[model samples]
Target: MTPHPAPQSRGVALFDLDGTLVDTTYLHTLAWWQALRRHGHTVPMVRIHRAIGMGSDRLLDAVLGPDRETGEDEALSDAHGTLYATWYDSLQPFEGAAALLRATAARGWRVVLASSASEEEVAAVRARLDADDVIDAATSSADADATKPAPDLVRAALDTVGAEPEEAVFVGDAVWDVEAAARAGVPCVGLLTGGTTRRELEDAGAVLVHDDPLDLLRHIDAGPLARPPAPGGTS
Candidate 1:
């Protein structure tokens, strides 16, 4: 048997689940709107959509304003959780999602998932991929001190995979993900699966933009994700 080269031994590919790996950003937007409506907060879907990448706490604050008392946060987040639960299977991983992860693993790269999603929600999402064979480690907001655009979440993911900040690349669909990756000093790759525009992602610090996880998967073997092909396949 051929030896498996460990691409991830030194650097890992960190992923943001929602817009980055799955097509659940808009679903999350609707869920948040319903959750807020249940609380009489009535946030607009557009704003909710814009805030989808943020963890519930940050999203609530973004839509509800910083003036909201910290005490109300837990209840609101719970409501959103219930609302989001209705769509557990509504979300499907983007094209090439599993392949991206598995291929990364095949290349000996450690694959880690980092998201603002709660533990249960993230578990459901990961279960859909069934990439237990590929994913090396994972982190969710439930385990992080802060969410995206802050680098805390990304750092948590790297730490989970026992990776260093400089040796990883983060992929996400939101401007905040780009910002967070930049802050963490990791290169950012943008996925258009989220609602954020290419310009916005670039402005936030994404250097490359792809259609989705699949696109990244197809191109990854060529870039920082690993060394070049093993050979004999270019023919």
Candidate 2:
């Protein structure tokens, strides 16, 4: 009988874009706020800020509620997209964000970006991040049927890298990210750069929490990403 091939063990590191690596959380909040207002809705910025990690559809449902008129949803989303795109050229990656991706890749992790942003937006963020050399893959909203708090995006990232749930770790800056990772059976490390509280992240199932990419890079060896790979796996 022929012997079966052993399991491939290189772990996967999934990173969330937007507020996690880029300084666009508030920008997103502002855009969504303006979009809603333009559509004659008046949701609070604070609420919009908290819903930044979700996809536009989910964000609309979240801030506007299920009872909201569905006819204007497309217009609201388009308005927000146009507003947010105005800042594309000005987007900046967080401190150490590129280094973090490089460091994770150097440690044998296949780094993948898991985001709910549109393809164009992801491209803008990636250009600002300047870490494409080390990124094994990246997934945008078009790659998933659902967004954060639903696990589809997270799972899509895993599939892109051919990684099993146990062989991957996700990093993000929101409770929605943590919750999504949890539902996908992947542990998540939370960052506070998105303005989420430590307690809120913890409550949502983050394995560890840090202030930002710089902070997490400083302690990378102590977090879930530092854990040894499974037996028969390399790295």
Candidate 3:
């Protein structure tokens, strides 16, 4: 079950961790590929890559098919988790990830890590980034009913930070992230660092896109994150 969220805050900057803040896109693809193969399914890495942002609950169907046996889902998820965990000690944050968070926080935005990753994984990534001092709060899979493209996680993150959707801007690296933010009525800024193309993110409704955290930091004042929070939580 998902946990109850804390109150909201103003001028929130909600961020996706995996492909947005850390360099885990290909690592996740490889882990999923290995897990699928373990169950005698041999999906290609490219197909897995495209489905990277979806939670494990939805990813198998996205890469495999809806008709796939439901019984194997848990096993597959566990396999992928175990496989992915092997790299926890080696996970690295993208360049300027911490600085970006600090800058956003310095500008009065409550920085929150809004990711679909498990809390353990989120913590690992946060440790690697070493920027928790500036991050006000975070929401993981345990805080949402669904993952990206569903809006549940994004909405949960907003609630966790006490920010209305209109008071927040989401930064992510996947089309699912943009779609999720749109569903939550928050503007999204897509990052190409997650291996997703700018065209894909923009088409999914991202108001702006940047190459990485550094690029966004360089132009923070000129982008969606710079928008002021709505007065009195109007919407």
Candidate 4:
């Protein structure tokens, strides 16, 4: 019998789950709004939407003002978490989400999830995706000193797998994600599955953009996820 070839070992593939893999961007926006309202803060949904990819510690500062009372930070973050947890069961992965992950794994890439969310939140998202078998590692808020747009989480993800910036590419759907990838010196591939637009992502440093995970999966060969050139060789 002809022997099957070994799986092609590409570089690591780091992913941001919330809006990039699952359809939770708007849900998070609504949750943040409700949480803020419950705490007597009235942040607009638009502002909250833009802050979705930021960590809870940074969200308030981004949407609200730096002048906000520092003491209320934990309470506000707790409220948001409490409210967001209610919709956990309803969270769903985007079309071809699991397939995309599995396909990337099949290419022998070390797949890791990089999220600024709490451990529970990240677990919920992973459960929704239901593709943990293909996932090699994950780094949540607890694993990082800071969050997106800071490079902490991205660097943590890379450290989890002992990968270098050039040996991996980040896939995400928000400007913060792009910024984080850039700070980590890793190229970013943006997806519009989140509410972020192509122009915004591009301006933030995404090397390429796609409509969603499925779209990216379909174009992987010709897209940013394509295998890099061999050492000392040009593509």
**Global fold similarity of model 1 (TM-score):** 0.89
**Candidate 4 regions off by >4 Å?**
1-10, 228-235
Q: Tens digits of per-residue lDDT for model 2 on 154-217?
A: 9898888677887888999999999999999988999999999999999998989999999999
lDDT of 1 at 61: 77
lDDT of 3 at 114: 89
Candidate 1 residue-wise lDDT, 1-235, digit = tens: 0012234255577888887787888888887788778777877799888887887777777888889877878888888788878878767888899888877777666678877788888888887777766677788776677886788888777777556776677888998898888888888889899989888888887879887887787798666665422222111
Model 2 / residue 217 / CA error / Å = 0.5
lDDT of 3 by residue, 1-235 (tens): 1223332436788899999999999999999999999999999899999999998888888998899898999999889989999999999899889999988877767888888988888888888999877877888888887777899998888777567887888999999999999999988999999888989988999999899999998998887666456666443
Task: Score each candidate by Cα lDDT.
Answer: 0.77, 0.87, 0.86, 0.84
Minimal lDDT window, size 10, model 3: 1-10
Per-candidate TM-scores read 0.89, 0.93, 0.94, 0.93
Which wins on TM-score, candidate 1 or candidate 2?
2
Models ranked on lDDT: 2, 3, 4, 1
Backbone clashes under 3 angstroms, per model: 2, 1, 7, 0
